[model samples]
Target: MIHTRALTKDFTVGRGEAVHAVRGVSIDIEPGELVAVLGPNGAGKTTLMRMLTTLISPTSGEATVAGHDIATHPARVRRRIGYVGQGNGAGHTQRVHDELYTQGEIYGLDRRAARTRADELIEALDLGALRERKVSDLSGGQRRRLDVALGLVHAPPLLFLDEPSTGLDPQNRANLWEHILRLRERHGMTVVLTTHYLDEADTMAERVVIVDHGRVIADDTAEALKTKLAGDRLTVGSPDVRTLSRLAEALPGARDLASSGERLELRVSDAPTAAAELLFAARDAGVPVTAVQSHRPTLDDVFLTLTGRSLREESSEVSK
Candidate 1:
């Protein structure tokens, strides 16, 4: 339940140079949809989220969140969306239950309803035992969950999570994912999240949007995005460099051919069909192929293929 048209955000760094954090981006998110925004750090994913959540105004363009015009009805938009930002929210001295109760009250919930929601969320988020514990004493994962509980204390229809699983262990990350899925399944809540974990996006999101250089690069279903990189990767182990070179020449779409120890790695569009050709070619050339393995392209492959670099690499470059 979010729509944006030609959204742009620019800031003047100094003299006259302007840094365009978000550039002419437009997207539509339907109700009850779990949309994952994938991007490098400076890809403007967070900036766009801020615009949608009414935390910041766009320099130009229009947006409607939960049927409220973000420019004119930001208060209504805020009331409809729960935003758990990158930073944690609960004060260090505030107890878990108190933090949630205060959040509910800020949203205009009565004491009875606030207490009820606090109790419910404390249990739902597995913070019942820590209800009386101060937030500073909680572990990173626990604190993150408490932040989410505070955000949802009012039970907003839409949730914006920016790297919600940051610093979480594998178990806690999976647990958070389960909670997010349940929110959608039971409450029909719309979730929009940004994450560095490609597997998380692959498993959780119904739609994937990739942004690069402050622009929308690709948007599609997770499967469809991976299919866009449709192909197989082949890794061959051989001692001879000549054999690897010969195999690369015979294989279509083979690039970045390199030798590591006794193995050669290169990318190919079709692994099953190409592996056989590679084997025969190596055989005729008297070069022995020790092992061959093929794997379908992953979301990382799609991102690297489209951007000529990995997501983490792009993010690092942006920070520089």
Candidate 2:
């Protein structure tokens, strides 16, 4: 479990300009819950995670992890939470098994206990074939799994994952999801993960928090957020821009409309009613509509409606 109140982090850049990475974020995560923090790069999700894991101190506010005060009992919080960051923690020269054994020892396990945990994690993470291989020789996905294993060898009650699926292919991503679900269902571990993938959050997280510009934009169950954007979308293709505008105005509950060369997209609050009206208006206007399709709102749609930009677009912009 985790709790934070008015958590804020600030850094002074050159010339006294302050970079507020995390600003006044307050959240409470219950035990055995999977919470996903969704955000674009530079949106402060990683900053918040780092503060919660005791990697960095907040400029002002209070936080507790697993009932231990982050500022007063950082060591206790660290012992109770396992953190798998974006970067690989294993040394290139170390073997896979040796890496985990070292982690166990650092956690205060004796030689026998460390070796036992190392072997157990190696088997559980399906790294038996590569146990003798050096970390540098492993693929990206393998290294990521090894990182997760190292974080879990001590069996912490809480886990923090920062983009755990980065650089992994579809198959490996699915495999990682299975491992994460097992940790929650079998071990009752509490998980807080930050990812750019909406599908991952939609599938794995019991609750979702969307952050942007150092602020919490939305927080709710994935289903509830999608329901908030409930409705139908109508897309029509027409060569004439004026005709597209006319159709958009004729459709009720249409908030946003986009026109491309012979294509028009509309965000409608009511799909069935708007669809019928759009067809009739097009027929009356004598504009040749090539195709018409209606679809339910998705997480992407909700994100766009809330932020005025797509999540992928925001991510690409941030990377630049």
Candidate with best lDDT: 2
Clash pairs for candidate 1: none
**Per-residue lDDT of model 2, residues 200-286, tens digit only:** 888889999999888988999988887676456777777776766776776667867787787777778777778778878878888
Off-target runs (Cα >4 Å) in candidate 2 are 229-231, 238-252, 259-262, 270-289, 318-320
Q: Please list the C-alpha lDDT of all candidates, in the order they appear.
A: 0.86, 0.87
TM-score of 2: 0.89
Task: Please give the range of 10 consecutive residues that has the lowest summed lDDT in model 1.
Answer: 311-320
Candidate 1 on 110-199: residue-level lDDT in tens?
A: 999999999999988889899999999999989988888887877889999998987788999998888777766878899999987788
